[model samples]
Target: MLPKEAYDAGHYVGVVAHSTANNGDSADGERNYESTTWQNAFVHFFVDDQKIEQVANTDYICYGAGHTANHLGYVQVELCQTTDAAKFTKAYAMYTWLLAKLLFNRKLSVVDGVTLMSHAQVSAKWKESDHTDPIEYLASHGKTWANLVADVSANYKEMEGTDLKLQTLILYSGDADLQVAADLAQHFCCPIVQVAFATSDLLLSATTKYQVGGASAPAGVTLLSGADRYATMHAVLTLLGK
Candidate 1:
C-alpha cells in the first residue's frame, strides 16, 4: 500500500522486509500461516516474486511496528520472507522496482549521503527487542540503508539545482518580471548598480575588478560610476545582443 503522503509529497518511498519467519514455511516458501493469521499479521503491503498483496489500507494505521504503529507519513512495503539468501534476491528486485516507481512517479531525486533508516529508527522498543529485518538483509547484499538514501538525496539536490537555474534564467530574461539582477548581485556579493553596468564587459573587466589590490569602483568594477554609466550600459547591451 502506497501512502497518500508518498503520492502527495512526490518524494519519499518506504520499503520493509520481514526478518522472522512468515507462518510455518521457510522464507522462500510462497505461503505462510503468519500472513494468514489476523493476530500475528503485520505490515500493509506484501510483495512476492509472483504477486503483490495488500493486507491493510494505506490510509489507515497498521500494526506492523510494535511501538510506533501510527507513523503519519510513511509507506510500509513488506517482503514476505525470512532471512534467507535465496529469498533476498527476489526481495532486492522487488524493493528496487518499488523505489524506481516511487522516484519516477513522484519526480524525486536521491541525494548522496542521505540516510534511509528503518522501523528501528523511529521506535526504540522495536530496536531494543532485537527486531531487525530489512537492515540485516540489506547489509548482506553489501548495501547500507544510508547509502541508498544518499543516492536518492544526491539526485534530488541535482534536480533542485537544475530547477533553480531554469528559474533564474527565466527571471533574468524578464519573462517572469522578477528582479533577477538584484538577486544575482546579492548572490554574487556585489552592488546591484555596479553589477548592472559591468554586465557589458563582465567577462573581461570582472576578473580585473575582482583581482587582489585592484582599484575597486562601484560594484567592484574598475570604471568610475559617474558619467560612464551610460557608456557601460551601452557596451553591456551590445554584448548581450539586447
Candidate 2:
C-alpha cells in the first residue's frame, strides 16, 4: 500500500498484484474481513477469480511485498488465488487500469518509459533462498523480467538518463580520509582537493585552496567550512571525487 504523499512525491512508479494461487492451495479460505471493522477489507486492489476488486485507496501502503518498507512505494494488488495455472486476464485488466489511472493523475505519458518492477527486482533477498513470485509465474506464461524492464524503459522518459553524473566535492583531513577521498574521486571521475586552513570555520570556506591532480586550486574556486574541519574537508573531498 502507498500513501498519497508517496505518489505525489514521485517516490513510487507503478503497481503490482499477485495471484493468491501462487502462495498455496486454492481451497484455502478467504481473508476474514469481519474480524476487523476497517474502511477497506482487502488490499488496495484484488484480482480474484472473476474481477478486479478495488478494496482500498491506491494511495495507501498495504501488507504485501514482505518486510521491506521501501516496497510500499509500489501499489500492490493481490489476487485471491495463487496457482501457476491461474489465468491472468483479470490481473492484466487490473494492471492496465491502474497504469491508466496513475499516468493520467500524475501527468505522465502513457508511453513514458517508467519501470514496473516486481518485488524481486527491489530485493534479491526475497528470492535468494527459495522464494519467487511474479517472475516464476510470468516465466511460465512466456514473459521475462528483462522484457518488462525494456518495455517500461522504452516508454518512460525518466528511465532514459540512467548514466547521468552528479558533481560533488570531498575534502580529506584524517589519515584514512585521503584514501576515502581518492576512492570516491576515482569513481566519479572528478577532482580531489587537499587544503590547509586555520580554524574549522575556514575548513570549508568557499575561499579555501584545493588541490586536484597535484595542481593548485584554480581561480574563483571556493572552499567549504565547518566545526569538524578535518571531517568536513574529507567529506568535501569525497564529494568532489564523486
Candidate 3:
C-alpha cells in the first residue's frame, strides 16, 4: 500500500496530466498495475476510451510527478495509452473533459502551465522529474498541447455556470454533424457541444436535446435523434418550425 500523506499546500493548487506510456493499456489495467507499484509512483485517476477510473482520492496527494509537484498539492491524472485511432479519439475526449471537470470542481481557471499542465510542463518547470510524457503520445494522435488546452478551456466554459438557464442544446459527433448542428444552433440560438458517448459529462439540463450522427445523449434527456444525420437535422429544424 502507498503511504498516506497530505499535500504541503493543504489543498491542490492545480492539475497535472500524464500518460501511462505503456501502449494499449486500459484504465483498469493501469489502476491494477498501480495497485502493486503505487509505492513507486501513482496518480489519482486513469482515463481510457471507456471510462475515467479513480485510483486514489484527490483530497490527498499522490506520488505522480516529483516531490515538488506532489508536495505543492497538484492533482495528477494519467491517460492510458492506446494505438487504435478510434480508441485514442474516444479516450482523448474523456481525458480532456475529465481534466476540465477537475479544475471546474476546484473552481480553478484553466490556465495552461499553471492550473492545467501536461506532465512535460511539470518536468520542465520542477526539474526534479526527468520524464516528459503524454506530449509525444498526443502528437502521435495529431493533437498538440495547444489543442488540449483549447479543448479543456472550452469544456470549462460550458460547465462554468450551472445556475444559468440553457433551455436547448445541440450535440454532434463528427464533422458533418457538427456543420448541421452549428447551423441549427445558430438558427435556434441553442448551445452546441461535441460529444463522444451517450453518457457524456458535458450533458446539461435542457428542455430539448438535438443529437446528430453517432453519439447519443444521456437517458431521459428529451432527446431528438433520427435514423440518420439528415433526418435528425430535419427533425430539429421542423420542431423549431424552421
Candidate 4:
C-alpha cells in the first residue's frame, strides 16, 4: 500500500528476517524479495550480500511492523540474513548504508530522532504488537542502538561527497550543513572550508532545507543550492575550482 502513496508518517523502521536460508545466495534472496512482493507482505527494502532491493515505494507504506497503524506509517526494511559472524558484518554494513541513503533522500539528518526507529521500539511504545526484531539479532553481535545510529551518521557523511575531490569549500546563506565537510575533504583529498551566501540551484524542497546548524559559512560567500546532493556536491567542486 505504501508503494502507491506517500508515507505521511515520515518515519522509518528496521527489521530482520526471523527465518532465512543458511546459504546466503543472491538467487535465494531474490526469490524471497519476489515472494514478499507478491504475497503483499511488503517492505521498502531487502538487503543481502547480493543487493539492496527496494520492493515498495518509500513515499508510501508497507507492512511487517507487526501492527496496523505502524504497518502503514513506517517504511519497513528487512536485512536478508546473518546466521553467523561474517554474514552479519556484511549485512550490517549494507543495512547501515541503506538507512543513511533513505535518511538523505528524506532530507533528515542522521542525528534526527524523529524518523529512524527499530521494530522493537515501535512495539514497546505503541503496544501495536509484542515483538522485537533485529535487536535480538544485533545483540548477539554486541551491537546496540547507539552503534547503529553512529553507523548511519557515518555513512550519511560519506554519501554527502562520495568520489568527490577536496579543492572547493562550501558556502551558505542561512544555516550550514557540515556533515559533508569531512567527506568533501576526503574526496577533495584535503580540507574544504565553509563560507557564506551562494545561488539557488537545488530547491527540491525549501532552499535552506538541508543546511546544518551551529556552523556558519564565511562572511560573504554565494548562497548556492544544489538541485539535489549531486548538484550541491558538484557546485562545491566547481567553487573549489578543482
Candidate 5:
C-alpha cells in the first residue's frame, strides 16, 4: 500500500495533471503497475478513454508529483497514455472534467499556473522535479497545454454556474427558526448559521441566501417570513424547490 500522508496545509491548494508516458495503457493497467511500485511513485487518480479510477484517496497526498508539490498540497491526477486518436479524445474530456471538478469542489478558481497546473508547469516552477510530461504527449495528439487549461476553465465555469444555483445559506434568529433552518439546511445539504453569528465571508460565498423567521438579513439576501413556523417552512420549501 502507498504510504498515507496529509498535505502540509491539510488541504490541497491546486491540482496537477500528468500523463503516464507509457502509450496504449488503461487506468486499470497503470493502477496495477503503481500498486506494485507505490513506494517509488503513485497518483490519487487515473483516467482513460473509458473510465476515471481512484487508485488512492484524494483526501491525503499522493507520490505523483515531486517532493515539493506533494508536500505543498496538490491533488495529482494521471492520464493513461493512449496512441489512438479516438482514445485520446475521450480520455482528454474526462481528464479535463475531473480536474475542473476537483478545483470546483475545493472552491478554488482555475488559474492556469496556480490552481490548475500541468506536470511541466510544476517542474518549471518548483525545480524539485525535472520531468516535463503530458506536454509532448498532448502535442502528439494535437492538444496543447493551453487547450487543457481552457477546457478545464470552461468546465469549472459550467460547474460553478450549475452549483451556484443550488448553493444556499440559511440564517435563523430564534430557537424555533433554528429548528426549521436546520431541517431545511440538512435537506438541501446547505449551511445553517444563526443570524447574529453569520460572517460576511460566509454570507458572500453563497449565491442563494435565505433568512428564516423575522431575522433581518443583509441587503440582497432573501427573507423567508410567514405568519407562523409552518408557513415559513412552506415558503422556504417553495422558494428553494426542496
Candidate 6:
C-alpha cells in the first residue's frame, strides 16, 4: 500500500542498493535485509530482477537512509546488488520504471534526484555509513548519478506525456483489477492520490468505473480495463504515449 501522509505531503524517495549481493533480489538477501530488526534499518520497497516487492509500510518512516531527517522524511527503496551486467540492466530498468510510476503517483518528479537519491550520495552528504555501495557499483558500470537522472527523464517522458494534477486515488485489491488503476497512474503521470476513505461519489475529468456492486460513480469516470496483471502493467507503461 502507498503511504498516507507521505503521499498527501509528497515526500521524496531515496533509492539505494546493496553492492555485495552480485545478483538480483536473492531470497537470501531479502531474509537478511528484513531480519535485521536490531538496527533502525529498514526499507519500504525492494527491487529485483522482475518484481518490486513492498516490504514495509510507506506511510511510516524507514531507518535506512543513514541520516535522521533523511531516514524519517524520505521513502527508502532497496535494490539487490547489481554487479552482473545482464542482471544490472534488468534491475536498473525495473528500478527506473517502478520509480517513475511511484514518483508520478506521489506527485514527485520522476527525473529529479532532489526527490530521488542514491543511498551512497545521501549517506556521504549526511555523514552516515561508509557511503559507497551504489556509487562504486555505478562507477563500475560506467553510469553516474547524472546518467540515472537522465534515464528517469527519458524513460518517464517516453512512457507518459501529459501531467495530471488531480488528487489521485487508487482503490486496488489483489482480487479486483488493480493493474488497471496502476496503469492509468503510470501514463497520466499526475499527482492523483489514494485515500483510505472517499466521498460517496468521485468527480474526475475522465470516465471510470468501479467493480463493486453497490458503489456509484457520479460522472466523468470512464471504462477501459485490462485482461491480466502483465498486460495491464505494460498498458500503463505506455499510458503517457496515449
TM-score of each model, in listed order: 0.42, 0.41, 0.68, 0.56, 0.70, 0.55
Q: Candidate 5 lDDT, tens digit per residue, 112-215?
A: 89989899999999888888988999999998999999999999999987775547788886788888889878877898888888878777678888888874
Write candidate 3's Cα lDDT for 59-108 as tens digits: 89999999989988888999989889999999999999999999999898
Ranking by lDDT: 5, 3, 4, 6, 2, 1
What tens-digit string does per-residue lDDT give for candidate 1 at 71-147?
43344556555356656666556554554344444453332212133555544433434556656656765767675
Every candidate's CA RMSD = 10.8, 16.1, 13.4, 12.2, 6.4, 14.8
Tell me the lDDT of model 2 at 211.
34
Please write out the lDDT profile of model 4 over residues 1-242, one tens digit for every residue: 23454444555443222213333545356556556564445566777766777766665666666555444466666766555788778877888888888777665666533466776666776786676766676777788777887898898888775524233443332323464545544554543343334333222112222222223333333443465555665665665586
Could you say which candidate leads in TM-score?
5
Give the candidate number with the greatest lDDT.
5
> Could you tell me the TM-score of candidate 5?
0.70
Q: Which residue window of length 10 is worst by lDDT in model 4? A: 204-213
Q: In model 1, which regions exceed 4 Å deviation?
A: 1-35, 67-73, 82-87, 99-116, 125-129, 150-242
Candidate 5 regions exceeding 4 Å error are: 166-242
RMSD of candidate 2 to true structure, Å: 16.1
Candidate number with the higher TM-score (1 or 6): 6
Cα lDDT tens digits for candidate 6, 1-242: 32233432355553444343354455346746576661546666777766677776766666666655344467766666755788778777877776666666666665344666677666666776765656666677788777777776676665554443244444433444444665556544532323223344443422343321113322443323346556544444454354
lDDT of 1: 0.43
Better of 4 and 5 by lDDT: 5
Candidate 4: regions farther than 4 A off: 1-3, 9-40, 66-72, 111-113, 161-242
lDDT, candidate 4, equals 0.56
Model 4 residue 4 CA deviation in Å: 2.3
Stronger candidate by TM-score (3 vs 4)? 3
lDDT of each: 0.43, 0.46, 0.84, 0.56, 0.88, 0.55
Q: Relative to the unseen true structure, what is the C-alpha lDDT of residue 2 in candidate 3, on a scale of 0 to 100?
A: 62
